[model samples]
Target: MNSSAFRPRLLAAAVSLCFAAPAIHAEEADVAQAGQALASISVTGARFDAEPSLAPVGAIIISADEIRRAGANDVNAAIRKVGGVYGRQSLDGSPDFGLDLRGFGTNSSQNLVIVLDGVRLSENELSNAVLSTIPIDTVERIEITRGGASVLYGGGATGGVINIVTRRPQANSRSASMFVEGGQFNAGEVRLSGAQAWDNFAADATLGTQRTDNYRDNNEFKQTHFSGGAQWFASQFDRVGFRYEGARQEMQFAGALKEAQFTAYPRQTLTPNDYGSLDSDRLTVFGQRRLYGHDIAADLSYRKKTVESTYFYDGVPSPATYDSKQWQFSPRVRKLGAIKGMVNELVAGVDLTKWERTTASGFSAADAEQKSKALYLRDELRFDPAHEGRISAGVRREIFDKDYADPLTFAAYDAKQALNAWELQASYMPVANVTVFGKLGQSFRVATSEEDSYTPLFNKPLAAQQSHDAELGLSYASATQKITARLFRHNLTNEIFFDPTANFGWGANTNLDPSRRQGFELDAEHRINAAWAVNAHYQHVQAKFRDGVNDGKEMVLVPKNTLSARVAWTGASQTADVGVQWTDKQRYGADFANDCAGQMPSYTTLDARYARTFGQWEWAVSGQNLADKNYFSQAFGCKAGIYPSNGRQLKLSARYSF
Candidate 1:
């Protein structure tokens, strides 16, 4: 018991389960068994809404049965149960997994924006979104849209967006499944999945492989993944679908540890022959139609990625390679009528992109090209329908063209940018279950092309990174309980970061003048009967730097309180789950220096799962962290440290279906 005294009794039992969630109130057939004990619904910031707590902001849905009841092995462990989402993986999880929303620190993949199944899986030269290239067994849900979606997914969304839906085909379902696991240090995994249908057509597939031999010491890892999909209906409302995914990975980078080598060898390895490698491919196609009253959709995608790395500064190695190709197109239309007396719904969209990249080694060789386009519109208004009110507005116009070349000697770097964004939302329910919302937004990001041709050599004057976002929300749902609360704020201006005093840590990509991030969030769910249930989330953020010389410091790994809780039980067919998380203590070097010295402490973790079934066979056991916690999820140098977060993980699994 010491984690500073068991972390205030686990943050006072997660604030007493958020005030006992309105003192549980079941009925309506116990609310579908309490919404299956936490998860589902919430279609990410509305649009043909699926009720994300009556959208207007704040959303988090992670189904696929909550990723198999949180045995989650990707999407950063199922997006850390929402709260204020945070994730950073290393020390064995291999080069990937880094996310932070609503307070983008360390450039969280250039401020969110990750979608799949609707294409657009980021990466304009490291605007990452490689959650192991989809394979939480082909996720079937994963909304998560908290704020500022850049007027419908465009340009690094400025802290929001994470679609990722997968799994299709229904008609007359057919199934197949397989999973296997092994744990403790020399980990292991295997997965195979299937689905099928006939007549109107359908299909699905998944395959996976994972390996680990990590606990430091040249952190080992290897991975492989693949996904497939197909669908067609062609009638009724017409539809079509297609998907494919692939991945290959390799790792070995053990490079951070200092603080007396993390109290003497926290799995040692401060650059054990640094390494990295990745390969990827993706394809997507989508279609939908329903003319007349409108409801059209279209999507197309293609992607390719390749990366190689070798680093070791003082020890000299420095290898580099990155190859990329991408193409995306999106089309949208939706409509609902009656405007004179209120009642309206309209959505419009157009986004297209083309990208190419190359960054060779043996000294230098570069080529980059990018093109983007965007046009967006949204409208939603309803005045009355029994205690109701709604209004939404959106606008977007984006344009970019960036190029960087140097095929031997024709050195160049060109850029052009155009941006416009807007969003305004309002909602009210007055009763009939409660809802209240507000939002105002704007987002932008630019200055890529490898940060303008190989990150400065004497060049400076790169701009584009703007944000202004706001949110206010409230929600309550009856029939067993659900709650949401929010208050968010963001104000960024020319805030591009990565400057460890110019270039010591591969930094240099600087800009920071105004910065601010305000926050308060809470999410709750309850059902204390029908086999127990509970859920909780909390966040309190304040990230800063609102002027000159580190105006108010803070904001470097942004974390000022975050908590999560979960509990579930079923019985008849057997199930059990438990969860806990807390993070608070962060600061690890940011521009405008905050007296440096680096810090990152504050951690708590626990996860559990149990499953049982027989008819079609299923069995499970899971554990992660579970009090074997001694954390430090991230930190970098200038003497900061390096990766070390992963301890106490156990696994056992079996599954079968036909």
Candidate 2:
């Protein structure tokens, strides 16, 4: 089908399913109840437990069961199914996948914020988050809050925020699980997890290791992760906890391929000896108390990471090491009361963080540091007792102090910046099972250490990036069906990004001219029957430079359209699922001039899984790229800089409960 006809047909099918929901047999009322329960689940990523219908923005929650149904092996694999989001493999050959949201293209990682159990996983560098270090088995749920969220997350939230909530021990219970898996291309993994709860104390721990000789030559990868936590409950509303996590990873890079090279030898490496290793450790202490109708909580954490890599420069071997450390503390309080005879909720919080990194090479050493502090407050008012009408407003002020020094070059630079963010949101339920919501906000981002070090202007700091964001949406939820459609727009100034054409082709990180990104998204799901279910999502985005040298030019690597769908079946002791994803063509990475000879080609892939439970154990088989399609979704130049997507692969796994 043609692109124009494809969208309408898919959308009509989804609408049909939603409209047909009312005809379902009365016996399926239980299914509707279950759907309603899921919709009411609280979203912790918003700083407080708030339901999607009660919030002004769009939010999607992926439960652990849904993750398993998708047969995702990692966090990146799981979240790629979300609307308006895309994932690409790391160029460095590490397991850290880059995720793009709302057409941010090459700067996606710097625009999106990632949080793990309330701890910011997004770093102050131009690098992606190490999602592979998070064991899938330990995750309870994943919450995706779309649009600018700087008012609560501080910074780097122009695209949104993703929070991964882990499983916790339940009171008076003890449980354990073990998982082992083996797959194509000499891949293997093992994981062990246990949790215990007694009296007022609870504890949980997980250990996992994985090794794989991926589909390409010289692309071996290995990683080990360990995490544990303990909590003491003084009362039903008070608690203290401690958490520790550590990870070690090593990998070999299979350098990028040119057109001819990729066509002839897609799985061969150009740089055979390139390799890297990473080690990270983190510790956190947190506590919460409730008194006098007020809830207070605090979190303190420290983290350290070391990375070493060796790659050929000018056909000569060169090696470097990076050491980084960070400290963070956050405290917040929430209260419920009455305002103008209406129900009201107020939340206030403070954030403080310090980070520093040192890079050592054969020539000289360089150092960089960033310190930030922020304060924010938000208030929500409900006009009715049923919460059918509500409005909220929030504001945040943050300050950053940055410094960079290079001994060899004798270059030292320091900068200070202050940024502000505010948002006004409203939601109304005019009829049963229907909601209309709208929000307007402002967000900002600061230059990373790497970006600052390569500024085109000698010692002059780059301006901070800023954006004006707005969204309007409507949603309908019922026992057997759920549908949501939204329109969003972002107008940005001084967008922090790398431009290869800058400084006479020397390529430096710099601020770009005015740009805009606007899109429409549609998401729908229907329970066909007691054992069958189907869901699909479609997104259309227009991203371009609004003014300047590249006026009206399409942004590089930002696809205009994307779609995904899935069907699942469940029986007495067996479950099966199938899914497909499609992406439209777009300009190559760094091709901001829109002068590339050819755009990256559009592609589609299929995935499927089947599992059966037997007594206290379960077994499953899964396959990715089932059709063995050949395509490349990422490229950095007009014709070269290609990274091929993996071909057909299959895996078998088993899990046991103890």
Candidate 3:
């Protein structure tokens, strides 16, 4: 896995590919034709391959080339390129990667909707889809709609949405690549992918594996996966595709950090038996097809997941081990320009899943299962001749098991709730240089299974959460820099947040009313020279629960301000990039005064990276946390906490093209 070995292998592959076919060079004018081939890739919400000068809300795109430069080993690290994104391995030494869309909260369990190639990874447990359930190796690109997309995507889209787009075979080339990565935190990984194209047939496959020693003692995680797809262009008017993805992930929990661990000045560590571990396996199969017209297409996906988790506290079993399984699927169809002045596209889908738990101590023999389903359709209106204006609206219905109650209190009361959502968006372009836009949408989030059937010691059932998103932005394109600015806000109701200290109970889902999160973002990308580019982004957030159970309390785990800047140099022989990020920290808990803990301190960090390519080989050398700063990303239950982050670590990696 050394750079030298990678270099030779890559050279050999390039030689083979070149000699395998008759060498022919195209003309200079053909460069555009060659580049256009890459543009054939299209996504659900992408207006076109052209990057929008102004985002509908706030967003960032990290191309595969960008990931390679940063030496990203997996999608978890590759996703950090976005301005507001942050990732961490939670206390259990497990993969708890999360995104703070529109500044809802830190962890995935808090809020946010995640999707993979149009399939709902957590379709069944919408509100509880943790990061470990996903296999990052297959992600080609991630499309993030930064604000709540509940209008079209109902449920759990409280903070917004993440659409994971996997790579596919192109009609023009067959390429293979393999790489290995190693770093601090006892991390190691290997990934390989191959794709081929011949006439009307194409295929692709990806294989990967990873392991990490507990950054905390005894809390380790290991994962393996395999995925592949094949497609046939039955004719110029029709096409169909089939794919399969399977994986398993395991982690030994290290429990929440103790106050002593964080207070330790120089170094902190975990003790044995902080918690036990669990392992899980998941498999999925999907099929899709497209009609001749550039206007119609459809796809369907199904997945099954089985998991086992254990718990240990005080060096003894805590009776928390459990196992479960589920089956889920989503089918969708889309049509473009179905009308003249009134353009329309409709997407209707349903979700079905069942779960059963093994009877265990401290937990309950509460063997129960649940099912949920939904169907939605949205139509878009675009008035092109009368200037530029577009409108979109949609709605959906949901049903969940209500009888799955706690066995101790066999007060079986199962009922299903149905909700409706809608959205409206408008964009105007008076001239070429400017485009003004505005949006308003209503979305609701369903409760997790745990939340649905629970008594917080002495409290009652927690209510479902809901919110609305409103936004406005302007885009100005210039010869050098492309400037885009946006101002948005989210109003929430029945927000469910963990309350460590509450009346009549150890913990309860406090209903916060009339709360809101507001923020502003400005992004600019400028080409300084033919070989140099500069990008800068600024974000500011002000969030708090305005009323109800948690009133007047500064929001927990929310960063008030952030600033990021990067300058990249591209040359025929090498590329270099350097970036810096500054963050203003806030608090770690909802009501700190009630829990005797104060607000968190703020910190800043800097990073630098460089990469070079020669022939069929590539190499990268980078330094993260260059300043070696120590700070916290998240915490829990007062003084005990583990910052889902590492300290001033260095990374080096190489890739071979074979």
- Choose the strongest candidate by TM-score: 2
Judged by lDDT against the true structure, how good is candidate 3?
0.58
In order, candidate lDDTs are 0.70, 0.79, 0.58
Residues 220-253 of candidate 2 have per-residue lDDT tens digits of 8898999899999876448889999999888777
Clashing pairs in 1: 256-642, 257-642
Q: Tens digit of lDDT per residue, candidate 3, span 552-618?
A: 6667667788777777888887888787777687666434343445656677777777877777677
Q: C-alpha displacement of 157 in model 1, angstroms?
A: 2.5
* TM-score computed on alpha carbons, candidate 3: 0.84
* lDDT per residue as tens, model 1, 376-481: 8877766675766887888889888877767665567676788988989887888888878888889888766655543546433367888899888888878898
- Of models 1 and 3, which has the larger TM-score? 3
> Which one is best on lDDT?
2
Consecutive 10-residue window with the lowest summed lDDT within model 3:
14-23
lDDT pick, better of 1 and 2: 2
Ranked by lDDT, the better of candidates 1 and 3 is: 1
